[model samples]
Target: MDLRHFRYFVAVAEALSFARAARNLNMSQPPLSKRIADLETELGVRLFDRTSKKVNLTTAGEAFLPKARDAVRAFDAALRTARLLSPSHSRRLRIALPAETSRNVLSDIVSRLQQERVQVHLVEASTADQQDLLTAGEIDIGVIRLPVEKQGLWASASLGQPLGVVMAAEHPLATVAKLRLCDLDPYTLVIFQRRFAPGLYDEVLDLCRAGGYVPHRILHATRMTKALLRTESAVAIVAERLAKRSGEAGSKEFIWKPLEGSPLHWWSSVICRANECVGLTRVAVDVILASLQQHEGWVPMPRSVRAQSEDIRPIEQRVDSVNAH
Candidate 1:
């Protein structure tokens, strides 16, 4: 079978629904079903047990899945290696990005890479997942959230912005110009998930306590606070610049306002395996730095040895003054 068939099977197996898999694969459900049927016929075994209520992988399917993934990975690795050795091959770079990464930052990076004649493949993942992928040699670069594990990795934070409050447009507090920690105490608030951003989540909670204000109630959002904002009247905390730059600014259903006193910030960084910083990874890092330097509030990491989340405090002092508007 071809890589296309492998991809189709993987997508269906992961989703456990032909309709969902078809949507993800950008194809009609009927054709996807036919492909699966043809594959089953070829293998002389049913891969998935189709039921009216749900779809599930058979024992045979489970046995084949991991091998299929390895096959795909090996093929891709071989193709990339061939391209690296070929003089006429165009340059390609794979970058892992968190789902909530800023659109402006991604746009700028893509723009710069295009100008440099490099093809970019962006993989959406969490900060932790991206780190794992980077460590495994699956991706050349990762632009992920801060507080990532730094062992065996070279990482630098370049973007930092004050946290903002997100609320439904109809919420009374949405009309307010700016909000203080105490102002949000009366409403239920949604914080970014601790698993996804433990440092930022704790920082926000600590800031509220320092102000002597505890929220009436608090909840957690999975990947982005924007989804919570759409359905809940409760406020969500997120980076103001990211909300605007990511096109959430145009949403008539939600509004984001800068926090008063500006005590908390969201940070992003570029990370890769420490020892593999030659060739494409090195070039990707330079491209990231150049793109970040052009932005107004982005702070370029120091050129010295790699720094961690603790090192960001000093940089915050300098950037806070500039971003306090």
Candidate 2:
């Protein structure tokens, strides 16, 4: 028989009722019954035991049920691969890299994908915007800061990115060996808008309060530039990787000082739709992780933050055309 025979057999086997299976399959019982009979004839066995009152699987049906289920699953996976991706979007992964993420991290990821002959289209988004884009299927994956609301998504293990303070070199605190959060109590805090990372935003404030620094005023800016980053009246608490790119760091007019105790351990992760991640999508994720391994300022994600709902497969288990191109 063909896939249809297996499909019909599985439906009948799972329901254990010819009439119920036929109704669920949207067909009349006669054809469904005949198809099951034909399958039994082709296999040279009686696959089911039928009586007036109820239905049950015979020994042969019980033996064949698992095989039939596997066949159905394989067929559906193949169908999704062939039909779900539009022609224009095929093999071209649309990705969102948030503003806080280092551009070089993305560049390295693209380089790895190129080695495997996969193309990429990139957009700069905040972690918050990336969340919306991923839900809408407008993009396949995103590199964002955690903690994300974990529903309908799968995420890679996080890499910890340490945070530090950036201010003008002439600022009073710049001379200290290591700065504490509380030391900046006199100055305003220049930070990213809360919308960029809602969870991180609230977490940072709590951390400041815990550290004994509660700013009287906070300035929220969407983009961090040299003009805003190294202001004398405020200090920006950001990742050192990001601070170096603010255009003033190279001039030596801005200094980045590590926060004592490393209190702000920013976490980064790659996320994608749980149900839709497969084939090339998985390959892309593996490649991205491999690329991140080449950079600094990343450590393994803590066990506590990983979502319990999805299995985050080990890199070796994921399929990637690492050698085949």
Candidate 3:
């Protein structure tokens, strides 16, 4: 059986529904069903037991599922290795990043790599979804928030930044030295949607709950800009970097204060599928780690480093100012 057959088989086994598998594979149900039938015929075993109500894997199918998955994974790994070793092949490194990560950080990394003549492509996505893509070999590396719990992935926590509570400049809390969880219970709270920032969202809820009150009102937003704009009569807890940028953009409407007694921090890192490092991937990882180390403990880089790198300068400057305060 070819890789395509294995792919079809794995899809069917995972979904357990021909229709759903076909939809995911971007093919019609009849053709997908026929491929599965052919696979079973070749193997001399019934992989799936079809029923009027549902489809279920047989014992043989169950036993073969993991093997099938491993086969597909191995083929992908081999293909990647071949491409990596072939000088004639265009070496394109694919990186996935979270949407909340500062554009400046991304731009800086890209700029440095481009200057070094590294061929790369970046995919922006949520941390959780990006991890999945990495696992499936859809991407080579991922720069995402820390605390990811996926198995077979390597992650490093490079640095952490404090989260800040942002409010309209005219809001009473804006004058406070530090904002407490209790202080925000009285106001509506705008938060990142669960899918985009599950860990952060859950942490915020847990912290608020421990303070003896649930947030009075909750508004969900997918994007930071949307969340900030929707903060009518509400307070937003966002990354310090985000708050600073928003404030500078004449959020003359808003002010931000460090959260008091909150363990809220933004952690960033570079992650990849475990043990899958190749030449380009290794170089990319090394560069990212080196950059992080060079800028460590300073909260941001000095003006020289920032000026030397156009993409990263703005973020570095903002981070430096925040740390200076």
lDDT of each: 0.69, 0.74, 0.67
lDDT of 1 by residue, 81-163 (tens): 67557664447788887775556668877877777778888888777567656544578788766644446566654566567
TM-score of each: 0.59, 0.65, 0.69
Global lDDT of model 3: 0.67
lDDT tens digits by residue: candidate 3, 1-325: 6788899999999889999888766699998988999999999999999998899999999999999999998988887678657774345678886765555656666776776567778888887677668767788888765444566766543455666677767666777786677777778778777766465466557757776537777887645544454456677767666666545224566666776764465556567776755456666766665454444321322222321232111121121111100
Model 1: CA > 4 A from native: 1-90, 102-108, 114-117, 170-172, 175-178, 222-232, 245-253, 293-297, 300-325
lDDT at position 53, candidate 1 = 88
Compose the digit string of candidate 2's lDDT tens values, residues 198-305. 877877788888898898988887465456655545788877766677654555788888888988877667778776667777788767766665564676645242
Candidate with top TM-score is 3
Q: Sorted by lDDT, highest first, which candidate order results?
A: 2, 1, 3
* Best prediction by lDDT: 2
| TM-score, candidate number 3 | 0.69
Residue 92 displacement (Å), model 1: 3.6
Task: Locate the minimum summed-lDDT window of 10 residues in model 2.
Answer: 308-317
Instruction: Output candidate 1 Cα RMSD.
Output: 8.4
